[model samples]
Structure formats: C-alpha cells, structure tokens
Target: MPDHVWWKRGVIYEIYARSFQDSNGDGVGDLAGIRQRLDYLAWLGVEAIWISPIYPSPMADFGYDISDYCAIDPLFGSLDDFDVLLEDAHRRGLKVVLDYVPNHTSDRHPWFAESRSSRDNPRRDWYIWKDPAPGGGPPNNWISNFGGSAWQFDEATGQYYYHAFLREQPDLNWRNPDVRAAMHEALRFWLRRGVDGFRVDVMWHLAKSAAFLDDPVNPAYAEGAPDNQRILQVNSTDQPEVHAFVHGIRSVIDEFEDRVLIGEIYLPVERLVAYYGDNLGGAHLPFNFQLIHATWSAPALGRLIEEYEAAIPEGGWPNWVLGNHDQSRIASRVGAAQARVAAMLLLTLRGTPTIYYGDEIGMTDVPVSGEDIRDPWSLNEPGIGVGRDPQRTPMQWSARPFAGFSRGRPWLPLGRDFQTANVETLREDPQSILNLYRNLCALRTEWKALRVGAMKMHRAEGDLLIFERAVDDERLLVCLNLGAEARQAELPAGLGRWRALLSTVSARNAGNNVEFEDTVQLHPDEGLVAVLTA
Candidate 1:
C-alpha cells in the first residue's frame, strides 16, 4: 500500500449517519452504531470513511443546518461517543473524515439568533442582512436553493437576512474577520480531538459578491424543475474571493500533520479545477462530481474522463464518487448489472474512488412517498423526482427484520429486496456486488499501476469504454461494456493477451488468460481488469 498520501491511493466509503446503523433502537443511526460497524468497514478494505454531518442541528435541513459547530447532536450521540468512534476507527487503521459545513448555520444557532436580534447588535454583521428594497420585497433577485426568495424578512428587525437554502438556515457573512476566526476555531476544536480530516461541504460558497448583485437569469432554465434554475448563479457562487478563504482553511488544516482536506464543489470542469488554488494550495481534491451527474454512456463518459484529467492541475490529485446521500444510487440509476461494471470503472480510474454505503451490495433506492419525504429540496418542489429519501434509506446489513438496522421501526423504509441484497447474504457469494467491491479494493492495494500510474490511453469503441493505467513496465487495462447486449472489441495493439485479475461478470478467474489477435468478446454489462506487460 502507498504510505506517502493514503487519501490519494486508498478508497473512501461515504456513510450517511442517520441511515448507516441504529444502535439504541431510536430508528436513527448514531455514533455508537457507527462504532459497532467499524470492523465491517475495515474488513471491506476502505482506507477512510467520510461521515455526513453529526454536529448539533435543528434537523430542518437534516444535519446540514448546524446549530453548533463543535458539539455532537443529541440525536447522533454525545461528544464522548464521537471521541470513541474516532479512537476505534484509528485503531482499526481507518481514517475518519467529518462533514464540515462552513457555508451556513441553522437559524436557531446562537450566532444567527444574536445577529438577527436587532439591526444595531454587534453580531448583526455576522450574517447577511439588508434593508427591504424600495418596492418592499427581497433585497435582490436571488432565489433560495430550496425554492422561494433567498432573503427572509425578519419581523422584529425589519430587515431581510439571506438564506441560500431554507429560511430556517441562514447564510453566514463570511466577509467578517470574526466569522472567519470563529469558523477556524471550530475546525481546530475537532483537530485537537484527533479527527483525521474534514469533507468541507459547499466549499465554494464560503464567499459571495460584496456588492450583493443579482444573479443573471439562466437562459437554459426549463419549467417545472430545479426551482432555482431560473438563475445561473454567476455572482452568487464560485466568487474570486473564495480562493483566498480556501487558502486560509488550507493553512489551518496544514497545522495538523497527515490530515486530508476535501472540498465539495459543484462547478464546470474548467472552473472546478480552480479550487486547487494558484499553486495547488486549495482543496487537496475538489471533488470531481461530473460522474455523479453525467449521462451513463461510454462515449459521453470517455470524453468526460479525458476532459477532467486534462483540466486538473499538474500536482492536484483527483477523486471520483458514483452516488451519495444527495443523489439516486448507482444501482437504481443504471440497473443492477451495470452497477457492477461501474464499480470497475470507478475503482480502476486514475484517482481516488469513493463508494457510497449500501452500493457495494447493489442496493437500489427505496420508494419514498410524498408524506414520508424528509428532504427539504423535495418537499419544496413536489412530484419533481427530486426527493432524496429513497437513497437515504437504512442500510441492509442482514436478513433480519428491518434489515437489522434497528429494532424499532426504521425512520425510512428499507429496500424491498433487502432480504437478498444485504451484506450478510452477499458476503458468502463470490459473484455478488459486495464481493466484487472487496476484490477491487484488494486489487488496488496489490497493484501500483492502478494506484499511481499515468492514464496512458482512453477511448470509446461502440458500447465499450477502454482505458489503460501503467506504472513503469506494469500495465493494467480496464474495459467496460455500457450496454445490455454483448459486443466485440478490438485491442489497440491488434495482438495481445493478459491474465484476468477480476471480472465484474464473475466469468474470469485469477489465472484465466484471455487472448485475442484483434477482437475480444464481452458479455452484457461486463467489465474486467486485466494485467499484462507494458
């Protein structure tokens, strides 16, 4: 295994805290439950775990509307429980990365409460507040990410405060030096507690335009979807000033040794790479989210890979994520069979790969009805297929009642196929997606070519996406079939043979030698990682 930068060479598993495991029968997962599952994660061979927010929150936007930065939410556990989770994770050789939300705070937060108390309050500048326009409405045309105007009218103060999402969550005025200092201290408090690192949430929103300018209209905006799509968000996000704030954040995290700082930025490829900073001092990896939102086509994905790789700074590392709490699961997006093929593409790519929890066992999104929906984004816009509760359902750990996630009724419904699609059931099946993930993880540790190799060539041929990763004379080729029908593919060299390291279809064994003069046959939704001499 590579030791210099474990984050760059190792696979990361993202866990949604509320749905991971429920220990105290509360139906909601907590710190203690996560501790009990540490062994399972370590056994799965992930180097690190990026847990969603566990800080004190109002649950308005779930854990994202944090009321306290340094304290653990009672629903999750106490601070002591968090310390134990961290200690146990490190003891098992696994790193723990917390989700850091520096962009906004719950309206119930003391800072926001104090800032909104009165227009003359000392902390009034702590949050963005503006007098109503002459026409008696929002200060600007900015729209809330969750729908409605971004500015909320404060009755007592007679001023409107900005909120990027729900009115219950107010955006912090990061331009204030005090706000910066306080947020930095919040980071230090965790670093002192021995947390490995942080996955900074909305890292690009740390700064906004000083002028409070109205965002230009989005010409591509379509009706009946993405309520905020009417605006392009030119002046509201990815501001030039954000890089400097990111530098300060980088400096603070650099104080601690061997700690990783990851940023969550959702911008185009050209602008996304800017988060790496002028000299690569920004985010260690500013999350390439293209894969999550891109079309699942070999030709489309092939061009995406080349463009993203080309846009990355020379020294900046890259990372890939297939699914997360915010989106639909991979299995549901591209059928169960294709998800296996996706695993090979994600793991073999020339960058760090993050496997969303439950995806390892081919978990699909559980249907969430309107009354059962928990996501604010979905509730704000009904019937738009934007509900996230389907993907945030409880993990299927076993065949036990409620998938063994909780003794009490679960907070959300479990997948209908949890009886067959579970860790315990699939752990014994060599052909299962769970075992496929295990083998791919082991493969990464075994081959340096897949870890730190240069991506020499990548191309799309018909329904197949082919790529090569090479280190010195060691070379590994990854070929994936994106369609449901079998296809014949030609090798670039016209004549070559390689030993199959692993196959998504479970057709090839370790010693199986696949040879071809020019063309090779691939089964439906098949992908393979094969080793050969350079």
Candidate 2:
C-alpha cells in the first residue's frame, strides 16, 4: 500500500448528477457548480468527492449511458470546466474520483453506431452481439437490470447486441484484448489529468462466463411476473478471468502513486473479497454494502459487524457506504430518528466511511409520478416500482426555485421537504442534523483513534447500541438510545472517570459512586459519546 493514498483512511463524499448544482441556469448540474462547492466540502472534513459520471452522453440513462468516455457532456459543462473543477478541488485538499463506466457504452457512441451499421465492421465484435436463434429472436434469455430481454435487435445488421443495463447502453466485449487496452488507455488519460482515482461502475459485470452459458432460473422471482424479476442466474458475470483484467487495471493505477481504485461489486462477501486479488494490487477497496443488508436490530447488526471485521483480506483496505445515488437515502430506509445513529456508526467503524451527498441534511427521496419518471428501469418495469428516480432527485441547497439548484426548472423535481431539509437552513442551526454530521466528521479527523482504531461491541441489545472504539489505552464508549425512551448502562468493571465528548441529546453524570453507574436519560432519537478516563 502506498503511504500517500489518502483515501485509505479517509472519508469519500458522493455527488449525484442533475442534483448537485446548476451552473448555467439549464436546470442541470454541471462541473462549474461543483467547482464552487469545494470549500463547503473541505469544511465538512471529507477527504474526497466521488462525482457520478459526467462523460458526454445522450441523457438516456442520465450520464451512465456514455457516448464518449473521455469527453464532458454539454449538459454538464465543457472539458475546460472539468479541469477547473479538478484544480479547485485539489487546492482545497479534496480528491476527486470519477465514476468510470467501462462495462458498457451508449448506442450513440461512434463505435457502437458503426458496429450496428454493418455486421462485418471492425467494431462489430467490440460489443457482445450474436445471431438470433432459428426463430429469429433474441440470442438468449438473459435479463437486463431494468428487466426484460437483455438483447436488442438491429435490423440493419440482423444481429442482437447484449446489454446488462438499458438497451441504449450495450455491454462491451471484455474478452477482446483491444477493448481492454483502449479502456486502460482511457484510465491512464484521466490519471495523467490529475484524477485521484476511479469508482468503477458495475465492476463485477466486466467479465462474463466464456461459454455464454444460460443461467439457472432464480427462485426468488417466481411469485410475480414482475419485470425486475430475473429468472436467469448472474453466472455470466463474476467470472474467474475478471481478476486478471482487474490486475492490469491495478498496475496502471500503481504507476501513479497515491491513485486508488474502488469497485462497485454487488456480490457475497466471499466473492467480493476476490476483487481485492491474491496480492495487494487489486482494487484498493470493494464497496461494503453490509449496511444495506443489516437490520436495525442490535443482535443482527452485531453479528454482521463481527462477520465484516473477520472477512477483510490482509493488505486490502476496507470501506463502508451507507447510501449512493442508486439506492434509497439512509434516512428513508432507517427513519429520520435513526439517521444520527447511522452517522455515528459510519464515522466510528473500522474502515473508511463514505457519506452520500445531501445525507448530512437528512434528505429524503421524492415520490416519482409514473408519468413524470425518466429512469429507464422504471420505464421498462412500469408496474414493479423498480425505478430509482426518487432517490436521484436534485440536491436541496435552499428552499428557493429549483431548490437553489438552477435558475430554470430542474431536470428532476426537488424533494417535497426541501423547505426544511435544504443545506442553507441546516447550516444556520447548530442543532441541525447537518451540523451533527460536520461535528462528527471533524472529531473523526482530529482523533486518530476514531480514524483507525479497533472497535469492540460493548453491550449491543434491543434499543441499546454500545461500542468501545479504542487505541492503546484510550477508549471512547459510544452509547445510543435506539428506541424512544431513556436508557442507562453500568460502566464496565475497571472503567474509570469519564467525560462526555459529544451527545445528540443533553446528558450529565452523577457526582460520585464507587462503582460508577453512568446513567443518562436520553430523549427519543438521542445518542452519546463519552471519553473513558482512568
């Protein structure tokens, strides 16, 4: 591990498209707006900001459908604007990790357009294409992430192309050596431009089963004819050959000191570990989605924490992500009362914590009316509610027009609760959830123990979350009132004098007791952190 890879022990803040800020009054977020927010991010104590894809695209899948990997989309800004944003972010001690979409390319890409134009074109094999079966239909029964057939027929070429996501975005043929080389060149180009790292999109799908074997039927979706339901197995992805390609990518990043690669892999822990490779040269971190699967119950979360701690491979760094642009916001999933607790849990954990943008202000997902939906997933699966549009709404900066996102109408509607959840309103309130996040992040940065300390669950039970974050003899006890009631915990044996470091609610200790009983009556949704003294 390089000593200067700041991301190893730092926090990553995620910024989503069409939501962050609009610079040109186009009702869309652009690089200039992001450039303007660098100081705000620096003050928040995040080490890096991972912006969603800004590559030139047709706006079919937002920015994920890329028409040109190396060019900036006009909707966002020009290439020069991106350069300015990078320079500004670097000056503020903030790293920028761009989202790299290598698994696929938009159908409008010249390469794809040419491939679709003729079956014998040089780029024909660039994308996964096949002749239809004897009946002249899709090559196979594979399903898309948005649902339905994964194959799209091109009458001009009389062949079908594979797309793991939206049909407009065709999956690239990773088996082709030229494709890998080109992708590597693109990565090197960005690194040369001063990008700190890349957040690989759909990393696991980069490799597929060589034989194109049909997947086994999935039993989970037998009940409904739901479009999101997948009957075929994902065996085509997560192939053994993927690591060798990833190793090549790692080699490129390693050449540039301090550069890192974070993969978005949605697989079991055991398989997810493979992304780290045998040596320390694979992806620096494979995002840990345990928080998504973890239930609010103490016993369940406790067991998961233990398992996660034991699963990380040596030499491979660890990272935890609570929310991202693709998923529902944490507040909506865990409830507003639990949001503060979630923040503490993230900051105190053993690995690098990733904070989704707008989470600091407790942003909620907007309800997307079917008629107003733009997500391809939702459009494809109209009845399944599979679209993630609500979660990807424009960020709330203020309660003004377009939620202060743009002078014109926003591409996406602002959250209905923006009046109360805007950043401007929260920034003024010391007790606001946004301030709580700022304080917690500041403490995490100032204290080495909070950054890279060992964590042991003290007494995690129903409606009571307790953990001891320790380094050497210094220990900090974090206790939370998970329920809507007052809670108390008896100081462990050998525990000494303690001082309150931070608390979500007001608290005070009893003057004197031989065996100290640190009882704090907390109001609903309150949590506390006390520095252990000896």
As for candidate 1, its clashing pairs are none
Worst 10 residues of 1 by lDDT: 511-520
What lDDT score is found at residue 263 in candidate 1? 94
Question: Which runs of model 1 end up more than 4 angstroms from their true locations?
Answer: 1-3, 494-496, 511-518
- The superposed Cα distance between candidate 2 and the true structure at residue 444, in angstroms, equals 0.8
Predicted candidate 2: what Cα RMSD to the true structure?
2.6
**Backbone clashes, each candidate:** 0, 0
Work out the TM-score per prediction: 0.98, 0.95
The 10-residue segment of model 2 with minimum total lDDT is 507-516
User: What is the per-residue lDDT of model 2 for residues 1-534, given as tens digits with 9 covering 90 to 100?
Assistant: 642358866889999867898888988888998987788899888999999999988978988999988889888888898898898898889999999999999989988988788878898888998889778788667778878788898888788899998889999998898889989998998999999999999889988777777777777766546553556556668988889888888898887978889999988888888899977668888888988767876677777877777788877667888888888889998888788778878877777889999899898888887467988877876866566888888888898878888899887878889988988899998777888888888878766677776788877777777788888777877777677766666556666766666666433322222122355445566776667766
Clashes of 2: 0
| C-alpha-based local distance difference test score of model 2 | 0.81
User: What is the TM-score (0 to 1) of candidate 2?
Assistant: 0.95
lDDT of each: 0.89, 0.81
